[model samples]
Target: MPPGVPAPPRPPTLPATPVAADTRDTVAAIYRAHARELWRVLGRLGVPPAAVEDALHDLFIVVQRKLPGFEHRAALRTWLYAIAVRIARRYRERLRRDAHDPEQDVVSPARPPDRALLDAEAVRVLDELLSRLPEAKREVFVLHEVEELSAPQIATILGINLNTVYSRLREARKAFVREHSRHRFLGGDAP
Candidate 1:
């Protein structure tokens, strides 16, 4: 080679291979980050309080199985939300089939008596209002109002268009307000 000639540009070096994430550590991290939120979401989605733990376990089992194939096409929270929704639906259906009454399983946490009573009544009224909504509207309302996800995010999680999410949320809000007013007017306990 001529002394003055520049060496041919080296081929671009390939990046080092990424280490595979440890499944246990990955699952633990995911649980640590999202468990509390998922628990609340499951309960609001109508999983009986007694079964919420089991449903959460089932949701993680699915995550474990599917984690390897996850392509990061959606945000992790959105993916988890989708899984919780399905698991919650299954638990709700099982409860119905078994003729289980969710209210009977309610166990008020230890608190000042007045606070506990008020909390319980508020939860009861909220649940009753949510239950009156159609499932589609309820899901939209919960994801938007409770989870505080934007309509676009809810649409992605629920596999619906953004407009549909907006429509359902609007309807759900109207129903919730109407029912709440009626409950108050009828002398239901106001917390």
Candidate 2:
């Protein structure tokens, strides 16, 4: 009926609270609010605990520089996760290049002995199981289970099909169970 008339502008679907015209302030606010999430995602991506903070710092550095171009086509968390995955890969490569061994480093001396032991065992078991999962599965599991992101959010973050995200999560759970059982059989820490 109105083919000859001009079309109206489509409203933006992305939420605008965290994203605004001032790039630096928007990015700084995001860092304040979501840096811990970035750290957790980086940890799941295989960034060593000692290096996770550094990786996070590095990630924000990228975000700070690129914030101006961020189109908000995706949720802020999804954008951060995508950046984290890339930074984790780079950090892992850098760790390999440097021949660093996180295990050989000294554990913190401040914690009580029993709690430290428990934490160490927990980390050992989790690392063992998560490392054995495929990279895709691990990311999906961590994003869905640990981070509590919805399937659609995880799909957006990973840029994968929605169905593929669900499959990976299912497979990751199975793989984790298998690995945990194996660890238990070996008397590592699993119950």
Candidate 3:
């Protein structure tokens, strides 16, 4: 190193560009690779199935448009999950504004042999239970329990403090257990 020479800027460790090549192929590949998982994630977040198609479509459009800007600081999957959450949140808002639509909505992007949607009874139970949770607690619970992300991973994905993630998980667990216990003891009579 020469005495007068300045050090060069370190190259970014993360990938500097997004995965998708063009908008069309990006949309198609995203659907092929991740649409089903995204739907499941949305379902657990309380996004009705009917709205999921439109919401997911919209999400992909946004992703396509934004892909070039993605710096890949996080794993691509985690980045996609964050996008899904935002899209689902917007869909829920629309539902609130237009209550005239059906109360329960389900999406069947990929049909399993047994069923196209969540078991009706299970969805009903989950929806009912999730309705009682605080928004923060519900999001963490859905991401961790339903989406199957670990706590530390979720904290990184959501860019939240690790302690906040743990706190939310505790609250969610407490609420879920209390609700489940009441249901079992009262034989489904509890609210």
Candidate 4:
């Protein structure tokens, strides 16, 4: 038995592979740390708040199971975002199918009374305006403005051109501002 050679460095465990179960704990830790922000991003991308928790859980489950195969060609957050957006899309599709059922309607998140008084009227006005926007414009608007994503990142996430993202953002801003101004003029400021 040789005792002076540091045990030959313990002979690496798993086979050399592109993906390994070895990364699971690290991935899970990163996911836990980043989860709230991820959900916020998905919500700003037009996922109803009601669907956000389930969507995030499902997304992470997929990540846990599939991430061993991840190629690392993109940033981990970007890859997670791609998954989140797909999950949000599926959530929206299901919501649409359930649209005609009264009991199936998605609920808006609850707001505290004091906070609602402070901001509800403005939020209500904005939500109404946003709801009226063309779907593409609303998506870009929320992603860029509410989610605070850069135009290039939005383009990448949505698989759209940068110019398209810019144009949609411009249109969304214009429409929202116009509607807000009108509402203000009409004194629709009650909370």
Candidate 5:
């Protein structure tokens, strides 16, 4: 306790707290669990295939930054899908601003040549049908049917009321079925 003695140098501050380590681990686990589904969901949500990978990366970046504050108001998958929807919307807006041709970004799924042709055609038809719906309806349809999320989950993810989800889903289904029937009547093979 000498008055002039310099205080002992503070113990080297640890670079990160255990809480930070826990956050990092949580982020990693979330990525491992949901990355692939989010990638697919992004593409289905209207992120051009060429940009889906970037969209997925951007999604995880947001997750990493915001996840510590996540309140668990919804299931993790629904929360992740909600994030993907926002990111995909941003990408779609950017594409619109850039006047990018999204069709050019469509890549056929890898398979035997014959099956690839069939699947490509099916995908094309489905995309066309999906594009015909209004955005709200399309979102409901894709979330409920394509992503296999329940109405309540879609409502949670889209921040809409559960009844609104049902309404949108009903309208979307009608629109989809109508369009699909037309395609079939036009001699297009049904997917």
Candidate 6:
């Protein structure tokens, strides 16, 4: 070793601080700001609407536990979205093993024709197309087109290459277009 001017002083270690309260506040703030988007992502990722609220709660618990170790290598929201995706995927797997479909429980009698129902119907149709897609293609399409994330950010989130993201997105777009054209109601005005 070269003669070093006396080694650099070690970083000062601060005594343990009350981080839990601060963490709670931070978590609360994150929930307040990003909960809706997280819910949307979870829904699109296939967490049944009925289970999304509970899934969101579970997601926050993981966030609280993992927040301290977050290194800021990615955008906070992106990291949260990644966590939400993982939670949703696991939830779907569990539900499959139990052979339960949450959508089967959603029954509404006494029809009220409203704008909300129309919108919901459209979303259902869209979900059917999305559900038909391979997970990789669906994720890339949603992250890019729906969530408006850049290609690079998506590559980071999915741990895939930039080229793969573009390729999947291309495939997803073509499939979505084909499906959309097949359903006249999807045109949004005339069936």
- Candidate 3 per-residue C-alpha lDDT over 37-117 given as tens digits, one digit per residue, 9 for 90 to 100: 887777767677666667777777766656655553537678788888788787777777887444334334655322456
Model 5 Cα lDDT, one tens digit per residue, 1-191: 33322222323333332334455667787888888788767766777656676888899877766666665454788888998888988987888898866546556574322243235766657777777778788888999898999988998899999999999999999999998888889997766
Query: Which residue pairs overlap in candidate 6's backbone?
Result: none
Query: Mind giving the per-residue lDDT tens digits that candidate 4 earns over 82-108?
Result: 777778777767767777522235344
TM-score of each: 0.78, 0.74, 0.73, 0.67, 0.75, 0.77
Pairs with steric clashes in candidate 5: none
Q: Which one is best on lDDT?
A: 1
The C-alpha stretches of model 2 lying farther than 4 A from their native spots are: 1-21, 71-74, 96-124
TM-score: which candidate is best? 1
Q: How far off is residue 134 in model 1, in Å?
A: 1.3
Better candidate number, 4 or 5, judged by TM-score: 5
- In candidate 6, where is summed lDDT lowest over 10 consecutive residues? 1-10
Against the true structure, what is every candidate's RMSD?
11.0, 8.8, 8.7, 8.3, 9.7, 8.8
- As for candidate 2, its clashing pairs are none
Query: Candidate 2: lDDT of 92?
Result: 69
| Candidate 5 ranges with C-alpha deviation above 4 Å | 1-20, 71-74, 102-121
What lDDT tens digits, residue by residue, belong to model 6 across residues 26-76?
Answer: 678889999988877877777766677788989988877666555545499
Clash pairs (backbone) in predicted model 4: none
For model 1, residues 1-191, the per-residue Cα lDDT tens digits are 33322222223332232323464456777899999899878877887666677888899887766665555454889999999988988987888898966546556574422243236766657777778788888888888889999888899888999899998898899998988888789997656
Q: After best superposition, candidate 4 residue 175: deviation in angstroms?
A: 2.1
- Clashing residue pair totals per candidate (backbone < 3 A): 0, 0, 3, 0, 0, 0
lDDT score of residue 122 within candidate 6: 61
For 19-69, candidate 2 gives per-residue lDDT tens digits of 333555666778899987887778777787666768887898777656655
**Order of candidate numbers by TM-score, starting with the best:** 1, 6, 5, 2, 3, 4
The residue pairs found clashing in candidate 3 are: 49-105, 49-106, 49-107
